[model samples]
Target: MHQLTDCQLIQSPDDQAAYTSAINENPANAGTTGRTRRKRSLFNYSKLWANGRTLKIAFLDNPPAAHKQKIIAAASQWLPYINLKFVFVDDEGDIRIATGNNDNSSMLGTDALLIHPDHPTMNLGVPPDHADFDVIVIHEFGHALGAMHEHQHPQANIPWDKPKVYAFYQNREMNPLSKTQVDRNLFATFDTLSAVHTAYDRKSVMHHPVPNSLTLGDWEVPINRRISKKDKRLMRLLYPK
Candidate 1:
């Protein structure tokens, strides 16, 4: 049985502003109507950063030096796959991080631009000592880089036993999630145009740890600790380094 808390994908509160900001940052995000014949991986292109650009990451709450370094190091695992550069800073960054809370979340890609300059675009609530700390940080950074939850991939036909799934998240002692949150975050299927449709990868770090108890069959995905081969392929396609 896997017991790991999943990170939620955060969107800018304003939809109109988010769309405008995304296109402005990278016009390719405004995808074309024509079909893309080649199979790629999961990601909303509209949420991707400008290719080959440097993204400044600010630590908003001034976490301990050791804690901050560990977080930066975990996030940097994605650096080799994408065309972007990460520059950690003290203030005023393209992606602002806050460690004052226990809720892990991040604004997808360029949507971070919609947030107030003083606010955080991402939150890393997990402490450095946690067993899954590195994996958690890497998963959240995947969102910060515009990757969606792998379980919600269009090709991932998970046979969820809805009632059990709902109860599991709702009754959890810490950070209980509402039914609406469960539906959107877990059961929602993204658009084909927004993703590169292919066989679902159970090993992607962006996937949630689904216990078999919540599914109709024995289907379950264990916590993926590292970026998978397909994840590398997807990032390469999106950023093209």
Candidate 2:
């Protein structure tokens, strides 16, 4: 079975953000499972990008012209709120993108610097039709900007139906991740000394959708397609003008 490689979850400061490397849904890297309580605060997962430098991005595989623009446009949504500039370039970049694959992920913050260009640091594998292209690119760029999954917030405790979650993703025709994989990518919440998170933003783009069946009682967060209002406020706080 393919272990899950990508998808945001909790992680220690020293470790690269979960998706910084390859994003395969294999089970090798996923950790133990259990539920934990999360307390809300201003969420900051990693060191912020150095100020006043354009974050360079390049697609090594040369995606279609329209596709490239779409990716840039989606990522640019984060630019207005944070102290970040997205500049497309011909040489190696801070975030290296690739296309025509199923594992969509990116390195968080300064971790992109550790990525080897030849290994495809980020993958825009799915086409617009099969996925919400705008949301996917924008969300990945959020990680590139040093953000983790809002769902994994220490204060934003989500009671996940672990078995149903494992079955749901595992049954997916493409990129079926095992239970251990789901535990790490979706259920595992890492404790961090640097987490400066705010109230749980249920509609934040960083949140993955939770089905009604997978959540107890009335708790259910739909797949958020746009950046939330809280996301803007938090970004401004993290990368001040």
Maximum-TM-score candidate: 1
Deviation from native of the Cα of residue 122 in model 1, angstroms? 0.8
Can you give the TM-score per candidate against the true fold? 0.91, 0.78
Q: lDDT for model 1, on a 0 to 1 scale?
A: 0.83
After the best TM-score superposition of candidate 2, give how far the Cα of residue 115 lies from its true spot, in angstroms.
1.3
Expressed as tens digits, the lDDT of each residue in 104-199 for candidate 1 is 888888888988999999988888888888998899898888888889888889999999989988998877889999998999977633366445
- What would you estimate as the lDDT of candidate 2? 0.66
Candidate 1: clashing pairs of residues: none
lDDT of 2 at 169: 81
**Per-residue accuracy of model 2 over 67-179 as CA lDDT, tens digit each:** 88888888888888987788897568777888766667766555565556665667776575545778887887887776777777777788777777788888987667788
lDDT against the true structure, each candidate: 0.83, 0.66
lDDT of 2 at 206: 85
